[model samples]
Target: MFIDEAEIEVFAGRGGSGCLSFHREKFVPKGGPDGGDGGKGGDVVFVGDENLHTLMDSKYKKHYRAKNGSPGEGSNKTGKNGENAEIAVPLGTIFREDGKVIGEILSHGERFAAAAGGKGGRGNARFKSPTNRAPREFETGREGEKKLLKLELKLLADVGLVGFPNAGKSTLISVLSSAKPKIADYPFTTLIPNLGIVDCFNYRSFVIADIPGLIEGAHTGKGLGIQFIKHIERTSMLLFLIDMTEQNPKKAFDVLKGELKKFNPEILEKPMLIVLTKTDIDPDAKFPKRIGGIPVYPISSISRTGLEELKHYCCETVLRNN
Candidate 1:
């Protein structure tokens, strides 16, 4: 399962306490006070790992904690420090604490401290003075820090493919890249977003993401709803595909536009390419030169019709924009 969101709690270790003792080595006179200082606590840290893409591991286990420090010993001996705890998450994951964003992990091996450990206490040996010799006093340790946090993951792709169910978007992605996504003749075959790397002319490469299909009332929670839309929010460009067998390509595009606009108005302003798929099934379908001032392309993944032109066009457009 592709779990994009999850909640967790982190706690740091507590500091150790101080110890006090009096020296009695059978000397001629009385001995002074001798005490040891306490050790410091551990910290809770979060790390980014590129191998992971989901927060499913955090879903089952919610809490993470560090170890507590040991107490101090007599004869000026300090306690052992606590061990630190490390949590690994995928890159492009955002961290939030109490509904406010703390920071985001954009690359692998990135580290962030979620909680800080408490400081150690003072020993009684340092409290000795000329006026009050052999005086005994010890301080207690401080408590550790704790926090509840939320994590959200966003996809990073150069191009995002958007269309209704059974529009041949998955088939096109399979042919374009080496990503092997499950394809079927029915609707909603893709439950999660799939990413693939497409290399174009002159060793130029880009990442593409194919999200779940959207329906007419997608913005209102119909047919995968906002879940699919959020996956494509970070794409540099969008490729909108329409089935060639459909009666009205303009209406299909309009519905997609309305849904995207309703969810996020900024999405409508991004550069987009209008394309018709499944040309092999309907060879006689009329191909329009332009729609709403945007160019149109008709392609067939099975027959590799117009596929090269489409790839080169996307590469050129993305390179120009970037």
Candidate 2:
């Protein structure tokens, strides 16, 4: 039910038509035009709410439309305006029009006008002048704007955790951060990415995301696909967790790096820290010397060993990158 992307159509309300009426009192006969102007239509707006983490709410209801304005009445009485429609979305959501970015929501309670309402029509009373005593011509109401919008949610994190399955990624995030992700001795336990906020000394805190592991052929829609890899592209720094207990730890790390390169070469350009996880199982395993000239660090999440070093390294790496 975690929907990250959705396509929806939005329509603003139309303006009401003007009324054509003449005043005819009991005493005063043939009174001048007394028609009232029509009210304006409603607008469509999108708001960002931090409480929402997924786009699942919008996925259920695709079409959104505002209410139309009421028609003008006689006796110079203006009609009521239509009520506007508001769509709430999570923070870090991007609004796109025809694949182009229209706007981006970064903070809570921030709102953007997606579609504007139409203008009200003029009444016949305004047309009455000295030249024409009984003018009957009145302006018509204008139509509102309609658009097909695309909403894409990208988790805003300071650092991203990326690696292959069974690399002790979930355990590392759970131990380091407050995010209690489902951890097991199996692969693909985490289907969706989890976000956690890691706080360091001196009130320094940064957001970390536990993106699902990527496997070989992930760029070609194999082994949980490359969606996990794409999510890491937005992170300021990447923590590549490799299972040291694997028979070929070097090849495992290489495959993970290769998948990332295939997904986006820019990902490899980001600041990366290699974490050799599951060291408790095989503490003397021969880890990789260098993958693309990046040094690897051996750590065990269960034993709480080398965690401080990894945390320090992550903090320094993030600061250096910034």
- Single out the weakest 10-residue window by summed lDDT for candidate 1: 226-235
* lDDT tens per residue, model 2, 1-322: 1239989999988887777889988998889887787878889999989789888988999999887777777788777887889999998888899989898776678898899878778788888999988879776667877989999997587788888888888898898888889988788999988887777777776678887778888889887898655455667788888777666766876888898888778878778877888788866666665665777888898888889987887777666665
**Candidate 1's residue-wise lDDT over 1-322, tens digit each?**
1239999999999988877876668653677777777787888888989789888888888999988777777777887888888989997788899899897775578898888877767678778899878778888777889999999886577788989999988898999999899999999999988988889988887778888888899988998886657667656788899998888889899998888888788877778888899899978767888877778989999999988888888888777776
Backbone clashes under 3 angstroms, per model: 0, 0
What's the CA RMSD of model 1 in angstroms? 10.9
What TM-score number comes out for model 2? 0.57
TM-score of each: 0.59, 0.57
Q: Can you list the residue pairs that collide in candidate 1?
A: none
lDDT of 1 at 93: 83
lDDT of each: 0.83, 0.81
> What are the root-mean-square deviations of the candidates from the true structure over C-alphas?
10.9, 11.0
